[model samples]
Target: MSTGHVEYASLNGTHIFKLIGEVRAHSCISLDKLLNKIEQQQNVVGAIVDLTQTTFIDSTVLGVLAKLGLKLKQVHHIQAVMLSTNPDITTLANSMGLGQVFVILNYCGDPSVCTLELTEEQHVTHSAMLNTVLDAHKTLMRLNENNQNMFEPLVKQLQKEQDCLNHDVQKQNA
Candidate 1:
């Protein structure tokens, strides 16, 4: 599988993100930053995640997307839309209860409406990556019972890693 990259564009009040190749936790920091920027913007009307070209996406990216869906609903009172052309990706999203947070459609929306520019990839620290991963799984677990059961053990493991990282940081500072 090819390495993944994220592209983004803001058209009018709508924001669009395109994920290509295999998206993983390494890309979450950039994705998270974009989501934060959108959340802060006024006049934001809609959000769309285009996964037509996405071959593979890991749990961390999914969690960020889930978090985006929930935030859009909570802060802007608008439900986010996710476009997935691949059946496998669609099935994965559905299994993770993304349908509850996003309007999962099987077709690619109007691509000509906005030009998706590539987001600048940012390097991630181990501490940051672990934190993002842990928070993401926790968010996914909040979606439904199935997700909760599926992610609880992973969350527990991530929490342990986070604790260890924190301890090491403290010792270094001491």
Candidate 2:
């Protein structure tokens, strides 16, 4: 059985990320961390996402990707190239209107030829994951009206869970 993985490297001013295996909601935690760091970078001139080895991507990961693309564009005026050979993924991306942010491709540049190592996964709490999911969906909703319509229910559900979690933490503290 294959687990999800997110690997990354920075070559000069170009940042490259490779998402492998099954990318699920939990993967968003790590991806969001990277994205936060990426957003703070000033030297990055371009970005690429390799999904060639990605077997599946959950909505949370997809939201993280959307956030990445929007950030790169807003910060650096760069359009992110998303590499994927899976027809299903490509179709799904199109259906979800991700093409507005990402330039989906079937192949990557020579970055894949380099020796890249996986980033160590940071352990995160269930609450943290839910928080990440909530933020990710909010980012998606901010993209456009269509996304807002599609993800409003999910965002509300996540927000409700987050509120409950916060209340539980307060009770525990009390």
Candidate 3:
């Protein structure tokens, strides 16, 4: 099944990113690309992550969003607001200590003015995906003590998977 997708629009200075359906590691490439595009914009002041229609969000995606928020704050001196009505998502963000990075909102004003720019999904190698997932989890781990405790096992698992994949690729090449 298709995991998830991201749509984004830049209006004025704030970039609006909408997460539709379930989001996983597969969506990170496009998301990262979009982030780059947003960075190139002339007058970017902030960003908003809309999760109103999202049904599921994996740890990797959450980590990516958290990192985005922190970068916007620390580097750009702007706030990244996450528009989410789902209690589960809100709770998860709080649990991961993302509240420090994101400003969660239940409603949005004039979203109609924003149109999403959707792109074809990017294909990533197994090792690449594994690395991305591992890095995302590491980012999450830096959020708080609880996040560190929660993602430590996942980080170790990803590391093991990456190691196995590397070995398999090496054997195939040999």
- By TM-score, the best candidate is 1
Best by lDDT: 1
> How many clashes (backbone N, Cα, C below 3 Å) per candidate?
0, 0, 0
The estimated TM-scores of all candidates read: 0.91, 0.87, 0.83
In candidate 1, what are the lDDT values of residues 113-170, reduced to their tens digit?
5555565455658888887888889889999999999999999998998899899989
lDDT of 1 at 50: 91
Over 4 Å off, model 2: 108-112, 115-122, 172-174
**Predicted candidate 2 versus true structure: per-residue lDDT over 1-174, tens digit per residue:** 228778777888888888878877866666688789989988888888888878898777888888899999998899998988889888877666678899999874464355364554467788887888898789878877888999999999989999999999999999
**How accurate locally is residue 19 in candidate 2, as Cα lDDT from 0 to 100?**
81
| Model 3 residue 101 distance off true place after TM-score fit, in angstroms | 0.1
lDDT rank order? 1, 2, 3
TM-score of 3: 0.83
13-55 in candidate 3: lDDT tens per residue? 8788898888777888678667756666667787888888788
Off by over 4 Å in 3: 36-42, 108-111, 120-122, 163-174
lDDT score, candidate 3, position 88: 89
lDDT of each: 0.87, 0.81, 0.80
lDDT of 2 at 90: 81
The C-alpha stretches of model 1 lying farther than 4 A from their native spots are 111-122
